[model samples]
Target chain A: MGMARAIEMAKEFGIGMVSIKHSNHFGMSAWLVQQAIDEGMMSLVFTNSSPALPVWGGRSKLMGVSPIACGAPAGDERPFILDMAPSIAARGKIDKAIRQGEKIPTDWALDSEGNMTDNPASALEGVMLPMGGPKGSALSIMMDVFSGVLSGSAYAGHVTNPYDPSKAADVGHFLVAIKPDLFMSLEDFKARMDYLYQRVVSCDKMGGVDRIYYPGEIEQIMRDERMKTGIPFTRGEIDALNEEAKLVGADTLNV
Target chain B: MGMARAIEMAKEFGIGMVSIKHSNHFGMSAWLVQQAIDEGMMSLVFTNSSPALPVWGGRSKLMGVSPIACGAPAGDERPFILDMAPSIAARGKIDKAIRQGEKIPTDWALDSEGNMTDNPASALEGVMLPMGGPKGSALSIMMDVFSGVLSGSAYAGHVTNPYDPSKAADVGHFLVAIKPDLFMSLEDFKARMDYLYQRVVSCDKMGGVDRIYYPGEIEQIMRDERMKTGIPFTRGEIDALNEEAKLVGADTLNV
Candidate 1:
């Protein structure tokens, strides 16, 4: 809803900013970036979630693994979309590992006792390790300040976990949309973006590497492939979705 | 100069943006952020420099270890300032290690052959390793896109090295200033920032850990101490400065 409004406002003005409070988790920020790109606009998407990572030098969780995402439009090329979390690995990966009974890498998380652990269950009981130590920790704090504090939402580790149903999530988001032609003609701006995309992907390859991908190129490729091949889902996943659909009296996926 | 104009424009309007091309290294980015803070404004500072780091999978140097910096003002408390390079360690640190005849950490850089090495000279010949691997590489690319490509300056590892006298540096910069009180009163924004600062510093410490610092707080502390006790410079440093001063017919610092 906020993104819809932001796009409308940005189309009228040169830029639009929307700060949302008391919201739920917005899945995959890149989708929002793509939405703005569809309108030929640049965007910045920021949000704060429940605490799952710790501040630097602290053992306990005090910050979210919230993502920092942004994008710019291009001409006849994939747009530049950057969506990254401060943590070395996403928390959902651990849950998946637990479901598959697989062991995680030691660097991904610390156990409840602060010891490095490979057990997925123990990793979930502990804290996700921030990437690049202090740099990642600082990035998480930056998100909280911009999204939570600025939006008057729960912050400073107070945001309720989505899994925890004791109270409201009270999440916060900071969204911005900027016209790509704000300072120059749309054609010129997109030409620059296309040139940048060419330079990045055409760089000399390293040994044993076949290709270099732009920030969001891998996802774009996967999306194109999926569009043709259709999504590959396991039987269990299909069953789970069907169950939810039945509960909501919605049409289930046809296998 | 761009910062001064940005401040003026932001003061008159609600926001300001300045894109500069064909410039020289502007030194520490924090100074620019501080300039905006002095004017009670929030700022984003970005620049592109000569190649010293590599893209994620590429062994060759193809990106600048450019710093991404931003800041916001606060009331009666230390403001938020973040200035960080994408590399594990700053390139200047390697030069300092060479001057002191010290070995850098093996993780700091790769040898010319793409192997990790502790020798500072060999590391200089090689590329500085990006922090958090792909995340840092993507960040450096983002800087180039915004500061170099968008500003119509040299990019894609084309910016001349500062120490290379073969050609002009032709650096580029992107600066933006936003009114912090755009959504609320200045006092409320500052109060929220103060609260964030307090929460971050007061986080529970891990085992054998000391006090945690807010972003840029360490530099503020160092600046305060150096203001009173003065900066400690080696005899060689002082002599080099005095020599340059003599050549320029300027007054030298007192010993």
Candidate 2:
């Protein structure tokens, strides 16, 4: 929708603004935020799903592997984008680990009884642990409330599995877009951001730590490097994509 | 400031909204959100601070103990409030532990070199671990960006210690308030929220877990209980307060 139209509709309803909730999985949150940025606004998006992990201290699968993304436009470069799941490793990453026959990280998951485990299968059976512990669990809970509860959608363990076709997976999403010139000049905001970035990066590092990275820095670098080298897909992922292409009766595997 | 005025000022600057980076360690985020609620809006706040502990994998002080709070006004009952820190325990709790001459929980903090320690002093020297591990670290980073980077405030280790006045701590905060009625009817929104809450809470628990608690459930209970039975203060806390009172030439312990 046109940003102006959306904002106008929001005003008409007596709502301060409209935040779309329970949106379909939109791939990368950065992509959607970029759309808002294109309309000259800053954006934030959060999504929640089935209980893939345990809350801090608790061993049962109780919370979703929620994810959050944010973006702001910059004049000379790509809009700043920050997108990540609230887990040490996202489910997709875990699937990849399983396919690669790699041992999952110990902290990433717990067995059914809540003991830490490194086996991919065990991690899958067990809940993915919260990020920091209680903090991550709390974040996951908040995401569930904002994106799911407030939206009147499924939450936590009750949410349908996004990966399962038989289920509707009543996923929920929360989005907010702010015009840059709301409180301060966009130019000034950008300048201040630059200053903050510089100061943070220039700070002294802890032992063995070479540098500090802002949230979106590594992602940007990864996008650039991957774009140049072509996207790398594991064999299983390639097969899965090819199978989907076949189902759609489309050409597959140009490479 | 009135919500309308704040929104109007923000709109003038091309900002679709305004989010305050509040200081004074606002005791309850819900209180701030209530302001928005009084104006018929939704609001969110995010804050970050020093490392209370390490991420999940290795034992080392790395990230800040952070918190994110949000509220959405309802029709009759109090607005839904969600406030939480990323750490298993706040630094203040450790101080309380010291005063009580009690050993801190094993999971709460680590020593200077990252070994788990129940000693409050060691935990103070060492960093407080993230709630989940990487997930906690990730949330801390997100809060740092939203509250610090975006809001043009200090973040992570760079934030000033709130306890120590001599240091120039630019502790960062982010606040956002929106009028939900702008998009849908208030009644409809509330009904939806009620449905979502009921469904999620009704879901079966794993093992012996008794009941599912919503985000603000515990806090609401605590607030009510504390209000009826005055908040308790430890002797050490009372002594400290008395010392400060003396500096200001005021009597103490009337309560």
Best by lDDT: 1
Residues B62-151, candidate 1, lDDT per residue (tens digit)?
889899888888888899999988888888999999999999877678777777789999988887888887799888988887788767
Clash-forming residue pairs, model 1: none
The digit string of per-residue lDDT tens for model 1 on A168-240 reads 9999998877776766789988998898788778776654568889999999999999999999999999999
Per-residue lDDT tens digits for candidate 2, residues B99-179, read 999998666776776567889988898767665544455566656656665555565456666687876566666666554
Off by over 4 Å in 1: A4-13, A91-108, A115-124, A245-255, B9-13, B91-108, B115-124, B246-254
TM-score of chain B of 2: 0.71
Question: Model 1: how far is B42 from its true place, Å?
Answer: 2.0
